[model samples]
Target: MNAIPGARPPDPKDLVRVRDRLTFLFVERCTVNRESNAISIADGHGIAHVPAAALSVLLLGPGVRITHSAVSVLSESGSTIVWVGENGVRYYAHGSPPSRSSRLLEAQARAVSDPSLRLAVARSMYLMRFSGEDVSKLSLQQLRGREGARIRRLYRQHSQRTGVPWDGREYDPDNFEGGSLVNQALSAANSAVYGVIHAVIVALGCSPGLGFVHNGNYRSFVYDIADLYKADLTIPIAFDIAAGPLTEAVGSAARKKVRDSVREFRLLERCVADIKGLLSIAGPVDIDDEELIVDDLRLWDDREGTVAAGVSYEESAEL
Candidate 1:
């Protein structure tokens, strides 16, 4: 890689707002290179130019070779890059850290740290999955029972609708082939949906590890959020795929369906709105207000509320 005559860093103020940007873009088996600001994807088919600044998330699946220049441009644009397995099952992700604002992350940390707030956030998420019922009075264990029943009903309903066999959900992560056809389909569909939801989480500056309901794993929040849409989006699609004639490429089919469904239902936009609502944010996360984008670094001071980050405080510390 060599420096170009007119190359320059992207202006932060001029970059597209996160909410306005396109959702996750999945690419596999391609060569990624930089052509000025846009990323060039070259594969067996050909090369295509994609504006890195316009994408919120870039999913790099298996068989992809990316360049340093490509990484630099994408990072400057604030796009989140993820490395994943087939059907968007995440393996690793890095790049273009969400440095714009700490509002959502701080709020999430506070909420999770407090037991009461954590319960309330969990209740809010459960309600999102089934708006018809009021589980505000229920405990976490009760909520889990109700959710389990609801998901079971959904599985039965989709199985009937798609004429797929009704069997219990069972799958081993290490051995994908051990599961039945429907189970395999469900796994593939869920993975695809999770990938997209994970992208949204990163774009909004939320920690995938700090979950309100589901916890323990690094992607606890990702699983928590993806649960909201499973009954509506992925489950039915999975059943339908299972109903179709068997294919050796069931995983590929599932991925394709999930991608099309996401685009068709505008799941990214709705996903963004749902997350903001759950987090108690008043409006779209990416607003055009100058004050929101400007750097306002500060230090936490319990007694005085805050102090400037950059200034030396050795005298105050001694006093």
Candidate 2:
């Protein structure tokens, strides 16, 4: 949906349903503007007003230019903004999550800090992935082995089902188009999954750096969460895209297919629910509270007519 000029900012109440309403929006070559507290994106052709609050993730790919006011409106709306290369091949940076409370984030930090609890969470993730296989007592190394085996098996299964030849995971970022068809498709497909899961991870106020199965990078948690759905969702889609007639637009095709399939599966909602379930150390409660702290935004307004200069609205709003 295109945003018209002078549209009212989305109601803060809409934050609760943003995940279910907008899954992912890939934008490029557009200038984002703040109109009547909402976002309006324009190019040389026309102006399209967008509801920044209702999006799960807004992918700012190549050529996208966002204004400061637009950034303020987006953050206030609680949507995750991702800066990435074309077709999301290379993830570079991301905006903070939408929540004001640090309750869930603090819980995540505590669980990941404790050795026993960290291992338990990792094992629980494995059980969920491998269909309840008992890995309660497995060492991290052994768990990695089992995970690798499962991944290999999935590659084989998908290859057989789709008749797409598998020659191991291989791709060069600088030379993506020159790689094998399936390998390129895999990269394209997995990047899309990572983008969506990263949004949910940050939106829930969790740290993307603190991961259970994966570590060391800013996207460790993103990788960990995306891995949960790769075997089932991305793997098959990549294979299917690769199996189609070779074309110059394989990467874009794979991306579009992954996005469509994700929507069909309601994967955005699933990602949010899974993050909550995995991180919930206590009995089930509302892991993500919809209550927003507007005081921070007011501070931003006083400083620069937006959020704090360096700090994101979410960070300023956090208690």
Candidate 3:
């Protein structure tokens, strides 16, 4: 039998350092001294030096280096680097595209349909949203309450568990006027998780716009999958790492810390196992096989439309 998949692997230390290098650029304007092969990012005329050894640079945009060598190294080492650009996020690898398949999509769909699996996803979202607490102890039924009631109860429970002050006021997106430290950190974490979930959904071959929960007009499935991961998996772990003494302002350092933590965390493996268990898949599903599952879902659609499971993929592929 094939061995059970291990935890999500760690990012290379070099990649982490390279990410740190780019982050320095974001917080300050920098000048690259090609003669010295070093980069200096200056803040208010004070310069911070970045060593060339820390990066494998490639020119992508004007005045911007893509860090091609670093990206290649990270991808080769089984890490995913999503570049968010003007056209939206694009996935890249050191060599070839990563494996994604349809059976995994079927498994995820089944997992979402299972009560226990749904609760696990919900609990993960809750814990991630409110760390330093035991939000996982709450039941799925309790979580399904009205938003105001759910938020109020969660605040009180979190406060009681962690002794952290939680004002019951609703979360206001506008409150970050001059950049509240807490708000900024939380927002960054949320965006990071959102990106990860989007990638997962794409890999799974399910239309991210269709979801079993957290319904919206657009990409509801993305929200649903992300919500499942929030409590028990991504958020709490991010908060735990971010709340530590080493945590800093919501800059590249903080973002890297959170991203690295998520990468090292075994959320994906656990998610895969839970999904497989729910779907009763006996073995690991190759991601490249996902188109078949999409075809299956389409067959279901066609049946509902005209009452028939018409031509199979084999027949279609032959044609």
Candidate 4:
């Protein structure tokens, strides 16, 4: 261990689990470098040190200068590094998934490829959203209609609770400022949850493009997963923030509220559980999450589950 510099690389178990990490850290007009195992940020604001391992998403905004060492440490820590545009929230790039195992990812692919199974997965997602509501008898179209109604109701409820005016959801991605105040807050809040969900989705090695409910985009699965929590996580926060006094700080304020709500609801932990449950991965209800991330090396044999990965079976083949 002494041969290693700036403290030893952390054991996998010692590193914080993806579900428990702090939501995000935004850095703009700052320089980022690795100091020991932490990331050092220097800017006109001052200097600060943040534990790289504790970060979920590190948003590098405008006027940011980052060192290679800093990127390396953040990647090693399983923290997502997002490069944004001049406005500070546009997404560009991110870090790789942390999972070494493909168990769940394979399950996802198999489920998504089959039409019936994919519908089944989508139905399961609906159940998660509605909880006690019975959706097994409904087709995807019916479910979609129901979901739309549910969201509209949520918008109304939040609007009344926060006393914020409810206009229909409308916004152009290219023109954030053109939207109304409530719309802007909703967009910002949704983006925050979407970013966190994107990190979780990729960290699990599941295909972001392989969505059961929503499809076509690269982050289809991210959109699908994010929708599950939007009613609880972002919708209310957005309305609450919008109802407050208008200021230039509204976007950041909405994101901050969403971050707090994420922790309060333990959204990350629920998200991981919901995904595993939806995919119908074979396991106990209380299976330890740590066990799922371990790489279970095996050679595929259609009928059999595990074959020795290192063995040569050429001579034993029927051919």
TM-score (all chains, Cα) for each model: 0.87, 0.81, 0.45, 0.89
**Candidate 2 lDDT (Cα, 0 to 1):** 0.77
lDDT of 3 by residue, 1-319 (tens): 9867733433333222212222111222333333233444444566565543342221121233334443444333322334432111121221221223355555556656676765554554444445465556666555455334644565455445545444433224445324443334445555555555544444334455545456554557656556555544433433444345544445344456545565565544444343334334323454332233223432445335533355553444644
**Cα RMSDs, all models:** 3.7, 8.2, 11.5, 3.0
| Better candidate by lDDT, 1 or 4 | 4
Q: Tens-digit lDDT track for model 2 on 208-282?
A: 899988879888998888888888788888898888786657778877888899998888888777777877753
| Per-candidate local distance difference test | 0.78, 0.77, 0.42, 0.80
Over the stretch 21-100, how does candidate 1's per-residue lDDT look in tens digits?
Answer: 76667788999999989999999999999999887778888999999989888887878788887655546765645455
TM-score of 2: 0.81
Worst 10 residues of 2 by lDDT: 291-300
Model 4 C-alpha lDDT per residue in residues 223-309, reported as the tens digit of each score: 999988888878888888888876667677877787788889988788887888888733233435555456678887877967888
Clashing pairs in 1: none
* Reference-based lDDT, residue 89, model 3: 19
Model 1 alpha-carbon miss at residue 302, Å: 2.5
Give stretches of model 1 more than 4 Å off.
1-7, 245-248, 281-294, 313-318
